[model samples]
Target chain A: MHGLPANLEEALLGLVREKLFEGGATLTVETDLFAAGLDSMGIMQLMISIEERFGVRVPESAVTRDHFSTASSLAAMVRRCAAPA
Target chain B: MKALSDSIVEAIFARAAEAPERAAFVGRDGEISFDHLVADVERWATVIARLPGFPAEGVARIGVRCPDGVQHTVLMLAVMRAGGCAVPVAGELPGDERSMLARTTALHGVLSQGGEERAADGSERHEIGGGLRWERLAAEEPCFPVEDFESVCPAFIRFSSGTTGASKGVVLSHGTLRERLDSANRRLGIGGTDRVLWTLPMAHHFAVSILLYLREGATVVLPEGSLAGDLLTAACQYGATVFYGSPFQAALLAAEASERDWPGLRLAVSTAAPLAPETAGAFVRRYGVRLSQGFGIIEAGLPLLSTTGEDPMVVGRPDDFELRLEGSGTEGGLCLRGPGMFDAYLSPWCPRQEVMADGWFHTGDLARWEADGSIRLVGRLKSVINVGGSKCFPEEIEEVLRCHEGVVDARVRGEEHARWGMLPVAEILPVDGSSPPTDGELSAHCRARLAGYKIPVRYQMVRELPRTASGKVRRV
Candidate 1:
């Protein structure tokens, strides 16, 4: 319902806020999601959300600790996944 | 005939005695042989048996709250083997929900690990090894009929997800556990040679998963973490052959970034929620093995499995069980009668005979019979949201939302999701038109009361909620 996020990183931050933490968390582009309590279930939810929202299917092999550490890191992966093969 | 308590304990020990050096559990800590596993379990049982107010001839209800590991398995097995009933208190539950479970189940004590925040009131704490501490609560008479509960030889009490008030928890007996394991293995054919890679939460899946693997003398591989990378590394390190977990985990494994393949994997079973066809397809393409989605009910053990791996929806024919439909049509409420059916429902105290008075347990799942005599789940008759594999009822979430000071009334429903199966969203009617509860406030309120999975992903302000003719909230 709200206006589309300006960029991919902003959009991912929005998604993380709404889905993973249920809008109760204060997050930024560089916040450590794992330190903020992002768990295995949260990772799965974010994976599916990325697929559904951005039409990006993050490969299983791409799910690494660095790629999932922050919103910006996830945004980079999503951008890569969205680019043409 | 041996008593139910002795029978299960003897069965497990007998396996260890036969192959003492066989690895029973392979986790991050290290591999534990069957003999060491049995010895550790016996040590915990000795501690449990000496707890204050432990009944000599009746069952003592003890809650086990721990992360999924060998310690969790040993404690639960110890509780059951020591002639007590084990109730798994999931780690994700908030304090309020935890207290509600304790009171409703009438747990005599709780064993917690990792120095959890709170212990039951009026309880004494004793330090158990492996970071586990047992809190012994003051003796109190149970609200339910204790005699009826003890008569069934209760082994485990699993609180049905989102259940509260009268329809509380499902009770599984020692004998019923044995029967269900036997029936499930008839289809699985798991033996000492199979090494199962375990990822699902032990609290939600112990009855049919870890217990079955241990009883069948199979080695269980507990991954360091549930990530795809961790699972793959564990599988290779432990030489795992069986992968039993939810579709979410399967999806991750399918999309795993590593070039390494799980060549030793013989069978992979997906359960807990319906599997999306894409996930099934991708999994096969990735690993050259089909993902067999199974239909596992807490009331009835795993009765149906999709062995052919053709249609993920079509759960293969019932094994050692009889299935039927509630209506004459092809698609109707699925019902079944078989071994491993739960012994009773705890709070309102309904026995198995009363529950199966009609000779079948209505699964509340809408299903269709395929031409090949397999079963395909169409939908659900109950208003439940399966977020990933965990289930939460809309009514329970609605109750929590209504308690918010800014909300007049609320309605919750499951929204179709691409990955998690279904995610819950809420519509709220505010008490004052001028002001409404902020999303952050509502989220914080719910986070303090419910599990993380049960919290709604989105909230919308509405003037009115759709209702039935009788004025009750009409569910879609």
Candidate 2:
């Protein structure tokens, strides 16, 4: 499966791990971030962090259940929004 | 001054007759004029009157599933006009949960928006105007003996947002509801010239805010969405006079980089949750309008309102209610006896006399009366966690976690945090010796169904959680 680019995924996962899972919780591409303790506020913070890191503004309309479902999903959203149109 | 009609339906009709062209509610669809509202309410009332088993003897309790919109307001009024008690059901509830609510309330019928009406019996569904669907379900089951809502002059029934215990329906009579509106408007002074910018869910604050605004001939403005930009655009475009929102919304508005000021906005009242000092200050700094904190409870309508933004910690003085502390000190259980107090609890059927002691309703909130007569809320007697001012009961989160396939058992608790007042943390036992699901998976499961504040911030795999002798998860 064509998932997020390896480097981008690593960077996103690193941020997720540091901000969301401070207790060294392991994560996978298919892992559900919400069930892993990433809440709505955490999602907002993650969006802000992503915006600052990738220079991509996550529009409010794009903030839905699908966009932040998993690590892979979030990475995909960032890639899609950050890509040159 | 002539005595105002005790019934909200009568008052609406009077207002419609007085000024037919006045806008009662303004939404994305368009403004619903009082004349149109009354006409539409009457049309829906006629449809409801023809429905079978619509309580031939007493007031029928009908469940309304319409979310925050113009149609919801119309449907609620129509239900009341049809001489039935309107019970608002959250549209986001799962099918099973909705059915549970229906059974719990022993509803005569259910009016939903844009969905096929589920029926256990061969009841036919009718398409009502204003994007509403109705079904008569009372005939399928024997009706439970409900209190005579008409006798008590009740206008609506709202369920408590409590997640820990069984949800109890708070019955507010028409008289009490009107009194609440009057008392709140005494402080707010909303008039024909005032246009309120609304953000909170309609189901939660309809009686205290929306109905009150409509009764006073003020216009209610519905934002496109909860986004800070959407709210700002609506407020500025519509010339919103008053902006009512929660602390979360305030924080979002504060965070947005847009350097715009809503010149028409006069007052911004925050309720339905606590207002954080930082959020209040940041919103004032951003919008150049002080965020006034209002202390409102379901049992007792808005009794205290902070008019001046002098102290963020103080929730202002009580206007129409008598407040007393159970124990002497700076802090104690905040108890109040108010004009718009709830008439009764539906399930288990506790009358006001039984629930209230010595004419005072003990608000579970722990608060301190300052030397200056201002009250500051300290904590809650109940184990409800306040996440960034939003109350989330751990029991609800624990119940949601237990529903996960990989979870065998779960216990949720609130951990005191610096930013958000409290953050919900969960400990889970994996099923069948399987590895516990990653935090991402659990949060995804929760975020899909539950509200944002209810989602846990931390999760840990544990063999067992501390429990009392009766096997209740010990919150303390």
How much DockQ does model 1 earn? 0.34
Q: List the residue pairs that clash in candidate 1.
A: A60-B255, A60-B256, A60-B257, A61-B255, A61-B256, A61-B257
Please provide, for model 1 over B121-174, each residue's C-alpha lDDT reduced to its tens digit, 9 standing for 90 to 100: 666888866677878777677878999999998889998452222236899988
lDDT of 1 at B149: 95
Candidate fnat values, all: 0.30, 0.03
Listed per model, the TM-scores of chain A against the true chain A are: 0.88, 0.82
Count of backbone collisions within predicted model 1: 6
Evaluate residue B320 in candidate 2 and report its C-alpha lDDT on the 0 to 100 scale.
Answer: 73
lDDT of 2 by residue, B1-476 (tens): 11235568777677667778988878675888988988888888777777766766677778787767788888898888877789887654545456666777778888888645362234457776666677667553423345444568667888746422545777888877877787888877888888998887676678878788888788888877656767888888888999887776777677764668888988888876667788888888877889988887777778888878767667888767889887877799888887877887766677788788587888888889977788888877877776654566777788889899999888887777644466778888888556679877887677654655566766889887788899877776
Number of the predicted model whose DockQ against the real structure is largest: 1
Q: What lDDT is obtained when candidate 1 is compared to the true structure?
A: 0.84
- Stretches of candidate 2 above 4 Å error? A1-85, B1-5, B115-124, B138-144, B148-150, B160-166, B387-392, B400-408, B417-420, B431-434, B437-455
